[model samples]
Target: MQRTDVNTLGEFGLIDHLTENFVNKQQTTILGVGDDAAIIAGGDEQIVISTDMLVEGIHFDFTYTPLKHLGYKAVVVNLSDIAAMNARPEQITVSIALSNRFSVEALDELYAGIAAACKTYGVDLVGGDTTSSNKGLIISITAIGRAPAGRITRRSGAKVGDLICITGNLGAAYLGLQLLEREKAVFKDNPEMQPKMGEHAPYLLQRQLRPEARTDMVDTFAKEGIVPTSMIDISDGLASEIFHICKASGVGAIIEESGVPIHNDAQLQALEFNLDPITTALSGGEDYELLFTIDPKDTEKIRFLPDLYIAGEIVAKEDGVKLHTKGGNIHPIKAQGWNHFGE
Candidate 1:
């Protein structure tokens, strides 16, 4: 038997290679593989579909992450991708690959979270597949959303001079994971210690166990009569997401390092962990906040919003993406997206 290293083809290359060979037989597949969600033609509106796969151990640790919270997190992540497209999620198909180690009651608890998220988001579960797996549990969720004609946002729509806006705080989720892993290690060595997690209680834990998607922001933007020139969720951190918007939009950006938001607890935790809060905000994944570029005029409308921040302004292609540091140093903002494939 021959084994090929998956790393031989980088993430993008692999996606391009696999998707390139397949021809779209259905006209419904309006777009695929390259963006946040695959666009499908639909009646009176465009349908957006996004799928996310989470593998136990690789994507999460069942020991610390409860089954119910994991279930909700999985759906939220997928829905976050849909929200990145400024689409309203209407339905979902959840597929699970599980081992016999999980009890029927355990599965019930997982679905309870899923059911809760569905009700909270107003999405219906249409269909899915359940299969056996020899390894850890695997959950794949495909979320379907809808948007009116010309309302759907894509990564390719950014233009020079567009204002880059990010919703909610950043770095908390990454720091949250760091805190959990550190505590888990401590607990393993001293079982009697009872976990000395003081200030880093709920926020960090909630971030790791149950990060919420900003679908409400999507709805708000729509009501405010503004369409993001381009958008991508901050799942892969601010730096990587900014790069995605830049590359797709064929523009550049100058994001203010100071303007990037970081929660107080996240900041304190990062300091205690000896991690730079800015770096964590830059490269940390799974924040699930929406990072988008809007027309300069729209900036005025949202500038006063509490959670949203005008972190940067898009620049010309030649300028390239960069960050303006606190001391006034301009440095290139590199792509530090999640390297799950280790490219």
Candidate 2:
């Protein structure tokens, strides 16, 4: 048999091929293997299911990425997808593939973080699979959630003139990863040297190791009577995720480059890394924040929102998606984001 490279299939193609013949026997599987999560038909509320996979070299590095945090992150990443759908995650299934290198104690530490997240978010660990792998450790998590049938958000609903908004700040995670990589290099050379994360400790280090999904923001919308016209999580960076929303909604956007939020510590870290903070904010992945749009009329609702910021507004397709530079130049916002395969 001839061996084929998986990258040739691409992520989307692989997903399609793997799920094409898998029929959903239950009527509850109204939507599956597509969209942000599987939308299930239920009584008054709909159930949403999402899964995420993290491989050693691709998703994270075990040398610095402690097993405990890795387990927690694997769970949170999938929940972020659920939150993107404006659903409340209720349960998760954690599956792991391990080699002889890991001991029973290591597994316990990993589950400790998983249990911590479940407790923090009020979710349960329903069930999952465990297997031995010849390579490094792998974690795959599936989150099951719920929301009112009409209240669920999707990627294909933004209308012209809707305001584009995002929660918290962006770019920190990518820069944080860069910092970690630098430290790892330094440590490799001098094992005696302690990691000098310095003042950038709390925000950057926390972002890289223990990122939290914006489920609280989804819950906040309920309290504030706000429903996003379209929604996506900033896992693939703001510029790329904004493209996903625009592409799905058949609309375009104009984001004020100056209006995008960046934290002070994150800015300093970016400067130290000799990176463009704005570019990082635009293209950094794994932020796990929410990017959404709302109607012009409801703009006031989020105007005073403490954690949310209006980055821009949706425009006609002819207007095209763009970013207004500080120099007042309009440039097309290309989705030159992290493509794990290749550009």
Instruction: Please list the residue runs of candidate 2 whose C-alpha ends up more than 4 Å from where it truly belongs after superposition.
Output: 1-42
For every model shown, the clashing-pair count is 0, 0
Write the residue-wise lDDT of candidate 1 on 49-158 in tens digits: 89999898888897689889998999999999999999988777677777667655576667778877877787766556666689879999999888886889999999
Error of 1 at 191 (Å): 2.4
Question: lDDT tens string, model 2, 1-343?
Answer: 3434434455555445433433444334465555655554466788888988888788888768987898788888999999999999876766677766766556666777887777777776655656678998888988888899888999999999999998999998888888888889999999999999769867987887899999998888998899999999999898999899999999999998888888888889888878878888999888899999999999878889798999999999888889998789998999878777632
Each prediction's whole-model lDDT (CA) = 0.81, 0.82
Each candidate's root-mean-square deviation in Å? 9.8, 8.9
Question: How far is 127's C-alpha from truth in model 2 (Å)?
Answer: 0.8
lDDT of 1 at 297: 81
What does candidate 1 score on TM?
A: 0.86
